[model samples]
Target: MELGLVGRTNAGKTALFNLITGSTAEVAPYPFTTREALRGRAEVPDPRIDAIADIQDIPRRVRAQVQVVDIPGLAAGAGQGEGLGGKALGELRQMDALIHVVRSFANNEVAHPEDAINPLGDAEAIDIELLLADREQIERRLEKVRKSAKSGDATAKGEQGLLELLVTEIDQGNPLRIVGDAEALALGIGMGLLTAKPVLYVINSDDPGEPLPELVAYATSRDAHVSQLAVGTELELAQLSPEDAAELAQEMELGDVRGADAMVRAAYELLDLVTFFTGSGPPEARAWPIQRGLSADKAAGKIHSDMERGFIRAEVVAWDALVAAGSFSKARESAQVRMEGKDYIVQEGDVMQIRFAV
Candidate 1:
C-alpha cells in the first residue's frame, strides 16, 4: 500500500513524513519543499512477527512494509496552477489513502498561509483545492460518457448522472466523501477523485495527550479519523541512534517508543489490513500484509501466481499454537495444523505452509 502526505504549505507534512520514514528529505519552514515525490518503505513493526521469529529461532525476520510518498504542499488556486499545481494533485490520486497534516502547533517563525492557526480553516483550504481538482477531472470525463449516454447505453447513463451529481457536490463546496455509497458511485474509483480517499488527520501539536476540539470535530464531521503527534520532536528523535534516543527519551520521561511505529500502525488499521506469516524454521521468516477476508487461493496469489495455479492445500496454524507446539513436525503431531483448501479464509496471525505442485 502507498500512502500520500498532503496539506497546505508549512503544515508539517514533510516533518511527519520524515519522522515516519526515517528519511532526511529536507524539511523546511516554507512551502513546496518537496517538489518531486519521495518514496520510502516503512516496516510495519509487529511484535507478533518478532515473537514468531524468536520462537522458531529463524536467521532472518522480515516485517511487512508499506510504501509512503511525500508530495509537495498545496495551496489556494492549486487546481488552477497555484502552488505545486497539477503535478501534486495528480500524485494525490495515486495514493491508497491520504494522511492530511494540519498545523495545530504555534510557532512564530513558521508562517501560516492564512496568518493564523485555524486547523479547520487549514483543512478547508486543502479540501477546496481537492474539490476543484476533482471537478475539473469529472467534467472532462463527463463529456466522453455523455456521448455514450446519447447512444442510449444504460451503463453510460448511470455514469453520466453520477458525474453530474459529483460536479454539483463540488460546486456546493462539499467533499465527495460525504456522499453516501461513495464507493458505488459510477466512475468514482476510475476517476481517482481525491476527496473519495480515506483521510487520517494528524494534528501537529505540542501536547498530543490533549485533544484539539476543533480538529476532532472537523474529523468527526467528515467521518474521518484524527491522530496527534509532535512531528518536530519526533523528527529530531529519528535522527539519533537507537541507544542515544532511548536514553534521551528516558531522561525526558518518554517511554520505550518511536513515532514511526505509531504513524504506520494507524495507517495499517485505517487500510484494514492483516498480517500472516510464511515459513516455519528456516533461513528466513517473513510477514505478508493481506487484505482482511481474503480466501486461501487468492491470498496465495499475493505471494506468487504459480502457487495459486498449482491448486494445492495448505498447512495452517495460529502463531501462538505453532510456537507452543515448537515446530511444524511437532504441530502436526499435536494436530495443531489444519489442512485448508482454496476457500479457506486466511486469518490474521496464521502461519502457513503450502503443498503445491508448482
Candidate 2:
C-alpha cells in the first residue's frame, strides 16, 4: 500500500514521515519544503506473525510493508495550480490512501502559512482544493466525451450520460466519489479523482495524550478517523530502542501507545486492508495484505503469478489454530485445516499452504 502524506505547508508532515520510516528527509520550517515525493518502506507491525514464527521455529519472519510517500504541501487556489499544489496533487493520484497532516501545535520559530493555529480550517481548505481539482478534471474529460458522442460513438455516448451526471454533482459542491453510484465510483477511480481516496487525519498536538476534543469532533462529523500525535515526542521515541523508548515513555507519561505506531496503524485500518499469512516450516513466515473479500486464486496471485496460474488447491487454517497445534502436520492431524478451491474466499488471519502444479 502506498500512503501519500499531504497537508498545508509547515504541517510537520515530514517529521511524522521521518519518524515512521526512519528516513532523514530534509524538514524545514517552511511551506513547500517537500517539492517532490520522498518514499520509504515501513514494515507493518503484527503480533500474530511473531507468534507463528515462534511456534513454528521459522528461519525468517517478514512483516507486511507499506510504502510511505511524503507529498508537497497544498495551498489555497491549488486546484488551479497554485503554489505547485497541482504538481503535488498529481503525485497523490497514485496513492492508495491519504494521510492528511494538520498542524495544531504553536511553535514560535515555525511560522504558520496562514498565521494562525486552526487545524479544522486547514483541513477543510485542503478538502475543498481536492474537490475543486476533481471537478476541473472531470469537466474537461466530459467535454471530450461529448464531442465523441456527437461523432456517433456508442461507447462514448453511453459514458457521456454518466459524465454529465458526475459534473452536475461536482458543480453542486459534492465530490464525484460521494455522489457517485457504483459505476461512477469506478469511473472516478479510473479518473483518479482526489476525493475518492480514503483519508486519515493526523493532528500534530500541543502536548502528549491529548486527543484535541475539537479536532476529534470535526473528524467524527466527517466520518473520518483522527490520530493525535506529538511529533516531537514521536521523533524522540524513534531515536531510541524499543525497550528504552518504553522506559522513557513511562517516565515522561506519554499516551497509552507510541504516537508513531498509532499513526501508521490507524492509517492501515483506514485503508480497510486485511492481513493473511503463508506458513511453511523453514524458509519464512510472512504476512500479506489483501482486500477483505479476496478469493483464493486471486490471493495466491499476490504471492506469485505461477501460484495463481497453476493453482490446484489451498490448505487453509486459522493462524491461532496452527499456533495451538504447533505445526501444519499437527493441524492436519487434528482436522483443523480446510481444503479450499480457487473460488473460495480467503479470510483474515488465515494461514495458507498452497498446492500448485509445475
- Compare the candidates by lDDT and give the number of the best one: 2
Q: Estimate each model's TM-score.
A: 0.89, 0.90
Segments in model 1 whose C-alpha atoms lie over 4 Å from true places: 81-83, 171-173, 182-186, 291-293, 304-306, 309-311, 323-330
| TM-score of model 2 vs. true structure | 0.90
Clashing pairs in 1: none
Clashes of each: 0, 0
For candidate 1, give the lDDT: 0.82
Q: Which lDDT tens digits does candidate 1 get at residues 148-202?
A: 9999999999888888888887788767777775543535656778887888888
- How does each model score on lDDT? 0.82, 0.85
* lDDT over C-alpha atoms for residue 219 of model 2: 71
Candidate 2: segments with Cα more than 4 A from true spot:
150-158, 221-223, 280-283, 291-294
Q: Write one digit per residue (lDDT tens) for candidate 2, span 172-225.
A: 766554654788778887888887777888998868666778878877655577
